[model samples]
Target: MTTNLLTRTHPRDDAAPVPPVRPHRRRRSLGSRIEPYLMISPTVLLILGLMVVPIVIVIGYSLMDNTITNPTPKFVGIANYLTVLGSPAFWGAAANTLLFTVVSVVAHMVIGVLFALMLNSKTMAKVPRAIFRAIYILPWIFTASVVAVLWRLLLDPSGVINYLLESLGLIHEAVPWLGLPQTALIAVTVINIWSGYPFFMISLLAGLQGIPSDLYEAARVDGAGPIRQFVSVTLPGLKPILYSMALLDLLWTTQQFTLIWATTGGGPLGSTEMLSTYTYKLAFNSYQFSLASTSAVLVLAASLVVAVFYVRRQRKEERR
Candidate 1:
């Protein structure tokens, strides 16, 4: 009986299979999880070394009286800022900067919107529209120096523009386009508008294209006229893009230097001298680095104010 029981128990145990062992799970440390940031360490270092360092230096220098000829910089607290604030030249430059930014941004938006609308029209030929867009963008692609030189040539008394005008009996004498103060300011403003409008046009055109054609079709079916559709649908759709472009244009125009420098050199009794040009002249030409820095700080403050206002307006509109 005992032998039989042992044999039965051994058979039952043999029929049962062994369970497979579970593999061990490896735990990742915090450093391993953040390895991606480690991979981009070089780029972060480069930005800090190149961009951040220079900006810090500029900020430091801005707080001190560092003349062009001086080897050492002396901290003068806020005295330099007070001097710049009190200067009539600074006020004039500030006014001119504001006028330039406002006029250029307004003109850019109006003209750009018109062009984008025309280009977005179904009746326009694709090839011709593309050519027109390319031509308009050419001015923006050209170097600032080249554009300045071209404008200088065109605006000169003996240039083709004046000669053609005189030949057509449009004028008895060649106008000194850049010689007079008012004319010089107008000329600079026109150049700025021309150079800047194409960028805004392209931006608005992209925004226009992003809008669904179905919306327009629906509007049409609902008895919405073109004017009504544009006002109610298109304008609202383009509001964000328009606001962004306007702010960008304002900032760019306010800080414009190369074109103005190459074209007018802030001449004709500083009539065309915006804040940027004024700051440059103060720093390099007049050897007043601290004062220049003060002006630059003011320019930065103005830019911040404009940007903040636009952002707030955008947020309010979005909430509604």
Candidate 2:
């Protein structure tokens, strides 16, 4: 009887009235929900004002004629795009940009991977590895303008490069590297490769470190040589990082302006002209803002495509 009375007391609460939530508790819950949004509002506003608004304005300008300079700009409905698309100079710039971007990306990958492998070598002493890493990363530490100026001096007709070549009998006379159409693009590309590879090297080095040592042990157990193990394990492990970095490098290299502008100014008969240079010339040099906007929009579209791939890759990695 005593046990039955003790267990039965709580069952009567189902028939009793329920307690209501307090107003203070409700207000606290609402405040908690709103706190995160309030904290991020400033950043959200900044992005809208800076990036999103400017991109929207540029897209709007691309669809109009005589933007900014004229008070009454007329809607041209893609006429600027047509003009830009039909121009041979635009095509030439696009071609130059393509070649420069592809070559730089490929060279960066090769040099970065090689350096990463060298640094990752178990045979390398710590002191030598640290020294080599610092030296290799030195180019990346310099600003684009500095890199351009340094390379310009190095590639000048009377520069140390020419002096060395002459002393070594590699060439009979001084070569104006940036002044010649045949060598301008190649020179800038080499310069870019030198400046850009450190990023890849750093990224790939981290990726290589994350790879399981057990994988290498397993590969050796199967009678795999160094080359075979690298091919089977290292490459596969680094593939995601490689793809993501390549896409980012492609986007960045395509939009490269300061280095090219400071070095060659897209000169030597337009041999090194890129889309960015073409857009800049149209807007500032020729005072053709509408056409420049169109070109800018086109470049944005290409960048967006690469960005989408990068984002998708990131999402896939997160899922794994």
Among the numbered candidates, top lDDT falls to 2
The numbered model that scores best in TM-score is 2
Listed in order, each prediction's TM-score against the native is 0.84, 0.93
lDDT of 2 by residue, 1-320 (tens): 88789778656655877798699989999999999999999999999999999999999999999788989999999899999999999999999999999999999999999999999998999999999999999999999999999999999999999999999999999999999999999999999999999999999999999999999999999999999999999999999999999999999999999999999999999999999999999999999898999999999998999999999999999999
Q: Could you give the C-alpha RMSD of every candidate to the true structure, in order shown?
A: 4.8, 4.5
User: In model 1, how many backbone clashes occur?
Assistant: 0
Give the range where candidate 2 is weakest over 10 consecutive residues by summed lDDT.
Answer: 9-18
* Candidate 2: count of backbone clashes, pairs at least 3 residues apart or interchain: 0
Off by over 4 Å in 2: 1-21
Give the Cα lDDT of each candidate.
0.86, 0.96
What is candidate 2's TM-score against the reference? 0.93
